[model samples]
Target: MTRKLLHTALVLSLFLPGCRLENLSADQLDLITNSVSSTFKAARPISDEEEYYVGRAVAAKILTSYRLVNNRKLTDYVNLVGQAVAIHSEKPFTFGGYHFAILDSGEINAFACPGGIIFITRGMLDAVSNEDELAAVLAHEVGHINHRDGIGAISQARWTEALTTIGSQAAKTYGSKDVAKLVGLFEGSIDDVFKTLVVNGYGRSQEHAADLASLNYLAATGYDPHALKTFLDRLVARSGGSQGGIMKTHPATRDRVDNVAANMPEQKSDAAHFSERSRRFASILGK
Candidate 1:
């Protein structure tokens, strides 16, 4: 028997009440040991720290394709708006905290990395009419993070293999070959997330769930939840069957708008609040 298996058996023997290690056949011992390991493997979920690392790598990969906005004022404004909504999300905090950035691309797209990194494109910012709309956008992305939609994109088989490798003695020893294998698995995971966020987009169910979550976050943060519906309405009107950027990656705009309207909270209007946020939004992004 392997040293790890033997160690597991010995540990189990000590803890198992009235169970004698010597009484069990070698086959029975091996079966028990394998069952314990399998149980642990099945129960393990990716840690927040691991998700943060994956998010960072995915962010880096995205940056390679789209340059970051060079204007500090614009960057800071986006972060401020993003954090305002994020603080009211289901997950108010993350392992690395939330970081929001703007991509210089004119594509109307946004991406939520696995942990707490969110990216919105210049076109998307322009698409929003006011700060509340921007908050709606950010809230939607935050929903993805709260639900772990990005991490869910990773193939189950790949994740299972990675967990098995991680639990092995070779991984513990950090042998060069094993280290390289781990790196390859990590890269595969990044690819899966990047593709989901940028290329294929999330499934319709995920998009709908995120929209519903966005409404909740917006209402909780004192932003108008109707802003989300309005944004989708604009998308549907502007899209006209065009398949690019967000239209390409997200579900049909009309469907999302319908979902939002169906689940919308009671309407609340504050003209003074609207004007103040609109002024702030225009000062930075323009009307």
Candidate 2:
């Protein structure tokens, strides 16, 4: 009996010795990967959670260096628009707070950051001719926030230094050097990556994703879907076909407009009415 028991124990021990425990379950890996992708987490392309965190940390620092336009009314008004559109976003506003700010910039631009921080340049606000136009711009930026564009950009880890270097000959793109460094975790290092993101601009695919998302949001909100196309048309015309720095990296505004027009849904439902406050937008910006 003792010999038989020893044999059984020995067999069990041998099998157990070869077995190894797994820290991440299949579900866990899928969750992390898909969730990050869905949110467009910036560190994703790097394929390291730590790298995403580090790059994002650098992104945060870069955001602070710019001069933000301070107006409680403007902030509140923009937030109202953001929240309304956000409720219908793919990811929704469950992750974190959605913030809106006005930057004292002359360029017609708006941007969304990871976790829902959004900014519209004073210049972009100046470009709006009506409530729908303004909503179109805000909705477009909100679309980026909702679809996680900023995070996605940070997640993609390709070295864009050559393009960035070419872009840095200008002054506006120069300030974003610190943000570009975070890409170094990939093939390069932080110093080089940060320089790249600021100068070269996000690739065409990202712009397409953002444009699609914006159209979806605009349709969802009952805003004229064509407003985005109109704005881009104006921008192209205004730029005299140059495509400028921002448009240069983004999908051709004309192409995107056509694409959006073709796919827009016919929705007659009221998009949660908003106080356009046209005069307020101009007055708050001191236009």
Question: Worst lDDT window (10 residues) for model 2?
Answer: 166-175
Residue by residue across 1-287, what tens digits does model 1's lDDT show? 77656755654544454556676667655545554454354346889998999999999999999999898999999999899999998899999999999999999999999999999999999899999999999999999999999998874756567656645632122345654675576568788899999999998899999999999998888899999999899898989889889998875577778899999988696889999989999888867
Alpha-carbon shift of residue 163 in model 1 (angstroms): 11
lDDT of 2 at 263: 70
> Backbone clashes per model, in order?
0, 13
* Tens digits of per-residue lDDT for model 2, 1-287: 35433433342243334422243354533332332233233323533344344445545654665577777787777777677677767866544456677877776666655556666777777777655667777776666555545545543433344324323432321123323342233334443334433445555566666677777777776676666777777777777667554455343566666776777666653444433344555566464
The TM-scores of all predictions, comma-separated, are 0.80, 0.61
> Model 2 residue 230 lDDT?
77
For every candidate in turn, the CA RMSD to the true structure comes to: 6.7, 13.2
* Top candidate, metric TM-score: 1
Q: What are the Cα lDDT values of the candidates? A: 0.83, 0.55
What is residue 81's positional error in candidate 1, in angstroms? 1.0
Screening candidate 1 with a backbone cut-off below 3 angstroms (N, C-alpha, C), the clashing residue pairs are none
